[model samples]
Target: MSAWAADRQRSRVRPGDPGWPSDVSWQQLNQQVGGALIKVESPIAACVEAPTSAACAQLFKSLRNPYFIGDDVALTQHLGWVDAWTSKPSAYAVAARNASDVAAAVHFARRNNLRLVVKGGGHSYQGTSNAADSLLVWTRRMNEIRLHDGFVAAGCGGHVAPQRAVSVGAGAVWAQVYDAVTTQRGAYVQGGGCTTVGVAGLVQSGGFGSFSKAFGTAAANLLEAEVVTADGQVRVANACTNPELFWGLKGGGGGSLGVITRLTLRVHELPEKFGAVDMSIKAASPEAFRRLIGLFIDFYGKRLMNPHWGEQVRLQTNNIMRVSMLCQGLDRGAAQHAWQPFLEAVSAAPGDFRFESSPVIVSMTARDYWVPTTLKRALGLVKVDDRPGAPISNMYWPGDQLTVGEFVHGFDSAWLPAALLRDDQREALSDALFASSRQWWISLYFNKGLAGGSAEAIDAAKDTATSPAVLDAFALAIIGAEEQPAYPGIAGHEPDLARGRRAAQGIARAVAELRKVAPNGGAYVAESNYFEPDWQRAYWGTNYPRLQAAKTQFDPEGLFFVHNGVGSEDWSADGFSRKA
Candidate 1:
């Protein structure tokens, strides 16, 4: 069956659910959304049990050139970019080229009291990033990166390439930005893990990277921001300037803070040459298992290790795991030297180990930062782009003591390597590494020495959301299924509850553990799964109260509700009921 038909049968909820009203209340909601923003329209008239003859009008006016409009015309002047993780579409969007445009939209929404969704350069798990029924404002066109007064001032309404970075910035488009800075400009940045995510999500969510252990989280490098408040006024915020907002935005999930228009970031020097490597283990024997886990523990305990060495391991099942090591130094040879210990630890046994390595050239000038995550996040990447399934939820993984064996061991069934693999590319890489293992694959990222290499200093900073555990890294589980579980009533239709629940339970366990390790630990907002609001509060803990206050003070009308954003009511004492 076609993907759309198959999904319709499995969606968690549909438009016509009882909660989706068609009465006067619905009409009133429609009217509010209609005039919420200038040049914006509403789609309430199209719903069944509708009111009058009028439908949400197309956003364009009588001008010969038609640009910007409702969901139908979103493809023209995109106010939002569709997320690649899931097929969930954004209802309406706006490409705000200037801050004034942002002001206009905010003011319009305030006047009409409509719900507004803000679009960054990435995706949300469901319809949070972009949706069909809500108002959207795309901020990709605001791409202008400049170096001014020893600081990098980036535009907000659109994607802004970083002004500078010592390594890389948080909320950066990993691969793309890495390629641009290192490959093109000979500079590099330490961004939030994923290459296709966004800076907005990263910065607000207290971004962490390989260098976080070295230089600290992306938030540590931030200097200031020009944000469009709910009041439709732009303000430059920092420890000195709206310090409270600055503190909240530092790691408090972007949407919750305000519409960030520009980010004044700290930039740094890049490494001369970097090493990227991925290794796999069969671990068919006890010795192999001991070596794998032993090496992991040793590396975690190392003190002489490179300040730039960043390593990660994923043991799928059967004691098999993939280890990725990155070290940034003056030379690739030196990087290799720092990585030698882990390599030796895993390759001690024959037929049980396989590894690959690549050299990453570093930037020497205009150090640090990049954005424009993925093509799907860009207007150009949307049409004919391949945005697959399952929305990515930002989660708080605050601990470092997790084992893949535990997750798969208790499943009461065999685990497939395919399940752990994020996409086809990883599968190919895995095949090239293993001749016998057919059930799993390892994903890899090079550009080691993120910040200072290990997460040791991060623990000291305690700067992340909820004061996350300082030593933990990040993981991105890319899957191709969008529908949640339900009793299968049709072909290819199965409930995602059990599976989703398992994922949630595992994440919940991780969060609980992190709180124990580094209570300040938190994950990027884009990675949130939207399973529990309270857990989310834990992810953005210390800042939730302040964010709510910002909403109450700036947007008392509560007309703005960006997708995946922390809603004002959700933070209120009464809001606790929504989590249930």
Candidate 2:
């Protein structure tokens, strides 16, 4: 056998070998590519009963926490890089400039028995973009955008390029797309509020935005995609070719079946400048808070049937309920006219409250509209190097007006105050939670009473893998502890395992309590609690079987996996490895 092959054989201990890359093994691998193909890893904990080698000890001491992330090559090659919220590190990272590069990376990962992670924008909340002991394929170098007839094709890593029908790269952020399309193409795309969020991840996660009422969801607008499946074959998925894959790609949740390299999205014309009414109401006491919540829910019920309307309601720890709205195709006058009923409801509320109106013609294209409100401000309070992921849950209001009002009052009155921490504990966690308060925020996307048969309407009969609950939903609700980490979904990486367990359990309790009100409703897969009891039922509902079938066909080897993603239940949550 060759010297390198012999070295590799020697390196493989009988389940007791040192986890060290010998000099010979490194030399041989590097020589094949004229240089290092893989860098030395930081000294991770060795498996039990590992063989002790002097060289391994030296390597460990000399190169503590060895990782390629800071190397010059890594800096240039890595596209939009980010680590985990818990600071978990990937074993190695490789950049893909083309489909072939992606295929090569896949092959190398499989051969080396390394977990593979595909990162387009690196904005995954659950930290799926950076997996421990995994090979990360960075797609940032593949940035290229092309416009074609009737459609636009975007490289997965490229900036957003717009046409009459825009094509957005998977890595392209919402702000970039808005800037490219709004002025040049005279169109607006439905996307998340944050500018830095990736189009690919958002769309694949059942995304919605201000214009959702008029334009449907970002997933619903997906026209086609180019993907590299588990077997390392580059494939095209659309209405006609690979239709099943296309359906799965629409909103089966990101990183499930394959690495999406490009996306073709359907863009709509700008109906009118976006207009909204901003109103804030504060209650003098807890009883007033209940009344304010009831009024807000009543307003939501009134406007829920308007396809061109959407509302964001926030219940703050200081007993403040803020309501902001977006009325697509409505001017300032039209919005005022439409909001009269809501205004009346608030005015007639029983409580000591003050309603402050900051009505402005906030153009959607303007910076003010794009700025994230409470969540962003809250994120800024406990500033860290990188923005952490949030723990979130989606609740749909399936009740009538009276039922919704009752549900809202009950949740705000019964659950929120009870779950809040005492003043002493609140002070300790104040940085993590902006106000040391427990808050529940809801953004209701009026999907009902939409102009039926309109191209923009969400069709339940459509084959996309997005949750069936989204089509029949009334609102998206998120409840979180203010004094906790801003990204509510991340239970946190406590050094004490027991402490971590308690923290997670606390979050699970809150989630369970909130779920009680929306028992019959489904959740948006993208912004949901990580510890969802029956995730399949909560996220995909009855559509889980079809999504699973598609996953089996495209990735029978279970190459691509993410937490809470389709077929992810088959794997262990701890390492995403196959279950015994």
Best by lDDT: 2
Native RMSD of candidate 1 (Å): 13.3
| Residue lDDT tens for model 1, 80-186 | 11121222233434456666666666665444334456766543433344444444566655555544424433333233443554322222333444455444566
lDDT for 182 in candidate 2 is 60
User: Which pairs clash in the backbone of model 2?
Assistant: 42-66, 389-487, 390-487, 390-488, 390-489, 391-488, 391-489, 433-482, 433-483
How accurate locally is residue 578 in candidate 2, as Cα lDDT from 0 to 100? 65
Each model's lDDT: 0.43, 0.53
TM-score of 1: 0.59
lDDT per residue for candidate 2 within 319-412, as digits (tens), equals 7766766667766667776677766766675457766554333445433343334553474411111213421111111111111101011111
